[model samples]
Target: MNQTDTPDKSDLSSISQAAGKDNACGTNSGTHLSRRGFLKRSATASAGILIVPSFVVSGLGHTAPSDRLNIAGVGVGGRGFSVLQAMENDANIVALCDVDWRYAQRCFDHFPNARKYWDWRVMYEEMLNDIDAVVVATSDHTHAAVAAYAMSLGKHVYVEKPLTHTVYESRLLTRLAAEYRVATQMGNQGASDEGVNLMVEWIRNGEIGEVTHVEAFTDRPIWPQGINTPKDAMPVPDTLNWDLFIGPARMRPYHEIYTPWNFRGFWDFGTGALGDMACHIVHPAFKALELGYPDRVQGSSTLLLQDSAPMAQKVALFYPQRDSSFGRLPAVRLDWYDGGLQPLRPEGWPDGRNMNHRGGGVLFHGTKDTLVCGCYGADPWLLSGRVPSVPQHERRVATNHQLDWIRACKESPDSRTETKSAFHEAGPFNETVVMGVLAVRLQALNKELHWDGENMRFTNISADEELTIIMEEGFSITDGRPSFSRPRTEPINAQAFAEGLIRTQYRSGWSLPPMPA
Candidate 1:
């Protein structure tokens, strides 16, 4: 909750390191860094990196194209560790932040120069000037909060796929990125693939006459789902910071079922299979075809659970043909099949050919040809082994995901320097994909939910009730903004919540000293 504007300029020498302690719940002295002494000089005393007042990069010392960025990371375990690893060639990891120490010990030991912390907020507060960028690899629900906080202070952010837990958070973060003009990238490596451009060229060249349908599939939810919520609470692990692990999520009792990875199955913690893999599986078609919002979306699934995703589910999305720079295209249907569900193989596809070449694939049915590719949009090819003369007109890159973002963070934006999956691109893609997931959530209501993506709400069903943003009281993104002190919209009373599904219960977690009544 110690959110505010970032210091105008950074002086790494002014920063002091905190003494080491094994683990603390973050209530008393051992909980965080020495905040008051983090920066020795007044914020106004230094000359900032930018001539312009805002939308500035944070690394004061590293200015050249070759200088390494002072990057900090939250959730530096699982996927987070790899993301940071990929950028190691260009980043000086100034700090490593994660809630689970046992899982994070590898990364901690790897980057001995980095100071470790249990909470991202404390890390950001104390190491404000030292970090030029933030890489967030937390759970789906916590993605937007951590990314938004870092971006608010003018740090470039690279968040893992799907962008945010809820549609609202995704939209808000998109706006924030544009407002801040900081380099932003969502973790969809396919956006950087040479194959994506190849596929786009094929579609644009009309080798595939006006793409009419898309069948995307993934065999996900390999984890537990469509099950009863665990009733028994377990003792919190000594190495895990339970409160910080919860982040902005509504507090729940410690349970093995929710941590060390399985959270993807839970509605509150992960995006199930759709959120987990669809960003990669569905992205090529989405980007090549320039799909924005869907006209409407609906779904069918095995018994839907309030606490977890269905064991198997399929979301069907309808999109009216929208004008694009390529050309006018016909209306299209994008069907997402997950939990091993798959669309009927298109009739024109050759007999004996596998519908899904890999565990996941995308099929674009066009009037002239059908294009297919694997999960990362790798090795795209037309049906019947037909290879059209696709002269490579689009720019090509070799494994440019993390490298592209790293470049964007330091260089000025131009044709070759822009991050391919910049928030604007990734936000809408995730928004459209998430709509299908949203449809699946209404299995009980069993009705097509028409979305108004521009308005960030549902038009027909008034699903605004479901769109409310809840957070632990002190954690609201609006925490430090005095202007929003009064409720602008009708305040929501939280019954409970999770990430990727609900507004986290935005109003809990505080042990503040008493104030004058």
Candidate 2:
């Protein structure tokens, strides 16, 4: 991963002033240092002055960890590797696990002392004493299993965005994290950027008037929909433990396409375009608007692939509860367009201003103005009128997401620079985006789902029943079901809504721990 470019010194200084600290950082107060003081001390500290110790010993601090934070990483490839690299400067990597040993082997070269495991469960049990935190960056299907297990052990966690494979898993994760009181952060690192926060502050201050609607779009295309394709099952490479790669995912014939990056488009392992992009694209707008559970969600999509395949393009609509803060505001409707799909622009915006980029982004339509921003959590550049200005505020931008998490792990939760990193704040955002994923999946099935957020089910009785039947049929209404089905032991946890379904199982001896009571 490329190093994050350093902002101008003047910009940093301005940010520090706005933050009211030498370090313009934000996190939960219990687990953070005074950013101002840290920056001040770092500036004068000599080469050998252990950075973390200087802050701790001086008590220029608050609550500090009794021991150094130990971190283990699962899925150390792609984004996972990036996160690991980011954390390397601040935390000790005690263990590394990946289904594809080859992928993780490269990472081990960097941390020669860390134990390596093909299965995360093995890492969890064997490295129990060596790890205080875990990073879960596996495929969407395995997110909940890894994270829930980690949190259950009272380990702090940093899971990738879109939280879980299904709404049920999302709820389970949130509950378990709360029960365990683990510090948690989703991998929507953009949430820590000053631009995203500025967008939130802008909306909170009504810069564009009360937001009534939002449009988010992504250019992601569906591919490698599943391993059921004609690709010949190849011999498992010696460097990779094929059985482990199928973790939590049902037993499947191994295909080369399923490995590396193509898994994101497959229903069995990933969330497709909606799940892959919505978390980053819609987060700022969702947070800025203080949007909560949607009253209803509906979706439409083009069936570009076979019934067994993931959808190529889709659109989802979320109708949120009315808010008095915006004055009898209309239910905020968020439109998500993915897989080269695009929403019709609001009536008055310039036609040509539409973004041509294939990546995803969000557009907020308020009473008096429209705001368009880049997809993938890029900073917002006012697309229309000047946003109402407020008093200058501090801009907290973390140089590294992993480092931020390490810093949080070392401090009490109350001292953290921002609370959003915690599951409470990140959960809702994940829920909202993942809901969009569920809606898209339903649309793919040509099912009309009328969601009742409070009830967390379709109000249409028949549809609700069909949903249960579908689940029984070995297909998850949120995430697609595996090619096979398991016996239904208990009624599906209707209350446990999940956008992605965890249908696959890990290789033998690599099962995730049961959800803690």
lDDT of candidates 1 onward, in order: 0.71, 0.61
RMSD of 2: 14.0
Listed in order, each prediction's TM-score against the native is: 0.82, 0.74
Q: lDDT tens digits, residues 47-140, model 2?
A: 2232223123323225444445678888987688888888776678877766665566568677777765555654554454557789889888
Model 1 — which ten-residue stretch has the worst lDDT? Answer: 1-10
In candidate 2, which residue ranges exceed 4 Å CA deviation? 1-68, 222-228, 304-311, 323-329, 346-358, 392-395, 414-419, 444-447, 461-517
Best by lDDT: 1
All-Cα superposition RMSD per candidate? 10.8, 14.0
In terms of TM-score, how similar is model 2 to the real structure? Answer: 0.74
Model 2, C-alpha of 274: deviation from truth (Å): 0.7
lDDT string, candidate 1, 1-517, tens digits: 1111111112111122464422233443334333222222112222233222122434432456787788998888799999999988777988987777678878877887887776665676667777888999988878887877566667889999878777767776777677667788999888788778889888888888878789898878778887766778998765666767776567789988888778888877788889888888888888888888887888888766567788888888888878998877678898888888887876666778776655789989888778889888878988758887866777665557998887777765433256778898898888876677778875444467666667655556642333232121121355565432211223332212213243334424321111111
TM-score of model number 1: 0.82
